[model samples]
Target: MKHPYSPGRVLCALHFTLTVFLLVRGRPKFLWFRPLSPEKLMDAIAQLGVCFLKLAQVLATRADFFPLEYLDKLKTIHDQVSPMNAEEYEKVFARAFPDPSCFSFFDSAPLASASIGQVHEARLQSGERVAVKLRRQGVDRLVEKDIRLLRGILWLAQPLFSRLTRNSLEAVISEFSDMIRRETDMLSECENLEQFRKRFVKSDVTLPEAYRELTSSDALVMSFIDGVRIDDKEAIGAMGIDGEKLISKLVVFYMEQMLIAGFFHADPHPGNLLVQKGGRLALLDFGMVKRLSNATRIAMIEVVKAANERDFELYILACKRLGVVAADAPDDKMTEFAERIFDIFGDARLSASSMRDIAFTTLASMRDLPFKIPQEVVYVMRVSSLIEGLGTTFVDNFNGVKDVLPVLKSNLTRALGAEAGLFPTIGQELAGLPLTMRRAKTVFNDLAEQNLHVKLSRETLDLLEGRIRNMMRPICQGGLFILAAFLVVGMELPWKNEIAVLLFAVGALRIVIGLK
Candidate 1:
């Protein structure tokens, strides 16, 4: 189907093409085309509309794609933007509130504006103050078109990038597409907020109570938060809040979200977090939430435990299990990589630039390896980087390694799903000892009976299958050509020559595409 707005498609296509061109030119080999300045690049992205702006924010978390200078500039791209125009406000407001008597006092002006939607301050008829988040009218369609446009651009540009870069780009765009689409659905955001509210009841962190009765697909109503942005140092200090203590709380909360509960608010930027009276934290904007499966969460815990213990081999193994490192990745190189990472985390006084340099150096050393960031871990990396950035704002020597590891270590048992005492856990394991021994005996008996055989891992089998299929394609095309030649030379039918020619052309085209 055609885009709902045709002119928007044209504008997005032009700006996206320019943005890609500028980035390509930024490479050292592109001497003919001068790279645009970082400001110019940012302007191009901003002009691409709200979708690309959100994309730029995601890119800010990726240090491998851009240098520190570009990262510095991209970090300034905030979710806050110009509020909706009168036409957009009227359309969304009318759709959100068919009955005008829902709110006794509803402000037409938005309290805050973002890429997906804007929040308005309102008072319910029962005299309760609330904040209503309204999805921008027609934003879902716009986002759909923008995602399609980006995919088209990526398809056109894929040949220009190396395999690793191509895969990374695809993964980033795919993850961002899923996340942005989720953000456009206000009902889903309400559900996410309610889940978080239930989870945070006993914690120091606060979540706005979602009013399900007053919510719909177009809008959500929740209690208004009157708190200071976590990064506003001056205001926080004026309120007699300890900056270090506040950061500690934020880090601990994140640790609980990621490691203990396995459900986290992916966007931890300062603007999405607020500090209420008495140094309490209030998390906002639950549109971009993430959940970790049991296997992933367990592997992540192993990664942290291995890192804290300084076991390079264990760390690399955990990384492989976590799906970040290829299963067949060379142990020596991976060990070296783990060593460098541990060294960076070991130094409390390491500056962000120094850490970046070390990481880049390691990546350069292992450039040939098939390292990848899976979709499941994309937001994990993003949240870590953003939280580290926030911590560095208040403390000079702050890092996630230095701050979060201790918290995770302290909560290890709870994170492992063992809330009860340790002796009961030991007793439970002992109770299963006979069953474990029986399974071991079965494996031994199979070996003794000569029934044991080597089995390839699922990943290895898939890789082999793909390689075999690729190798056979051209062979099959050549066979088709041979059959066509035979038909032309031996067949006596009236249409034999015509069929032979058509078959020959089809075979040649297939072979040519495979070679390309």
Candidate 2:
């Protein structure tokens, strides 16, 4: 089926390629993926370059599902992707920088390389030490193919899989795809870096100052940050630096990132974090940041309270309010899951027992639950692991989980007024009751006086435009199915008319609901 503009075709080709490669794959990587663990596969995919590598990195951020082996292995697939050669660097510099002829002192060699792009150690003609990041030439198209293939694979697997909802998986992938795509636009990333830096102005965490004059859509140049990578444990030890304090700073750093500033470095792995000799963790790569809205921030505030008070139910409720939980989950199922989580949460606070004991007990208790966790839990669980992983490694006998609760508790108490309740909000709304009644009476009076009235404003115009746009999306999609059908039954082409009609129906229903 040679459908014009079908991204699915690229996906089909990739599927075929992977299938053929795996057919000839080493006997080690077979039946239930034993040939290569999920982690090793990620490394191989990273080696393959393009989107697959990026995917492995994102999945590595998600430690909730994969075992510790995969997490440890995939974490090593660092930003060390192959760099573009000198010739390509020159061409890109010429394209991105104006007055390229005047350029006297830019390094042709990359300073660093990740799966998607490489950073070159460069000096401007102005004698500034800058880091130049260049997007790999063919990455965008590869990402497009990779994203399409993932969607196709998920769509095809919907009926066969029971562990996850297709919508849920697709939503997470779409978000990650959006983030990875943002990395392609170096200009946007530069702006993001500046924004994050600005947000963290007073904070100990900092980002490299992006050199706007040397920056462009394809290339980003920032003042070179000089520090040892956080993972350089040997160097850390040699300097006699406090690793536990650094991690403590990170915990507080990330807490402030989301809580106070409402801007967070979504990827805060050991690679992206650098520890200065004085102990400040220099945050790198602001390209994949997440900004929380006021509402989201409030939800997170509640999450802090819940995590501190050992309130799993409130945490679950907060998750639901934040739209982090799927709506289709059964109430009882979620409650039971919450109960099990509470057991873990309570156990996590136990000081008498070791982490391994708590973990073992938690694992044993999980056998009593029927509900599975959503993938987003990985991001949260990763935080827990970071606290524990870095904590145990540096601060012997230090329970990161136990330590975090006190900080969160003390902070929440100081920030949110120890006794603020729903009553205050209700009272505020009640204070506006007179105005609401006046408006209601006015509406009724207008109806009686003029038979009908609809006050119109620019706000109404904006609302109407939003409604129209939503309706148009589904209609435009339906048109494709209609066109496909016309070619099938009308033009006598061998086609899946049934599927086309179904798609049309789905689109029509969506449009109808949009209008409603």
Model 1, which residues run further than 4 Å from truth?
A: 1-26, 29-36, 361-366, 424-516
By TM-score, the best candidate is: 1
Candidate 1 residue lDDT tens string, 1-516: 245357765655655554544453345433344444678767766766778888787777766556666778888888777888999899888888889697999998998888789999999999999999988878898899888888887887777675555666787789889998998998899999989988777899878998898888889999998899998999999999998889888877887788888899999898889999999999998899999887788888899888778788998888877777666678898898767766786687777668667777765565566666767788888898898888877877577677767766777777776767888878888999999999989889989999976787434653565576676779798678857767786878788877787777777777777767
Can you give the lDDT of residue 368 in candidate 1? 64
What lDDT does each candidate get?
A: 0.79, 0.62
| Clash count (model 2, backbone only) | 9
Least accurate stretch of 10 residues (summed lDDT) in model 2? 19-28
Per-residue CA lDDT of candidate 2, range 1-516, in tens? 233126655444344334322322223332343335454465456445555555555555443334445556766665565567677656766777767543456666666677667876766677777777777766666677667776666565555333333334555667667777887788889889988777778887657998886677887888888888787888888878888667777777767766666676777667677877777778788677666676666776787787666566776666655545543344566666655545544454454345445554554444322222333333443445545555655655555345665666656642453335678757877899999999999889888889676665322443465467667877777676666655556654455677667666776776677567
Error of 2 at 340 (Å): 5.4
* Backbone clash total, candidate 1: 0
Listed per candidate, the RMSD to the true structure in angstroms reads 6.4, 10.3
Off by over 4 Å in 2: 1-36, 61-64, 67-72, 101-104, 238-240, 323-392, 396-400, 413-516
- Pairs that collide in candidate 2 are 28-35, 29-35, 30-35, 79-113, 79-114, 110-120, 111-119, 111-120, 111-121
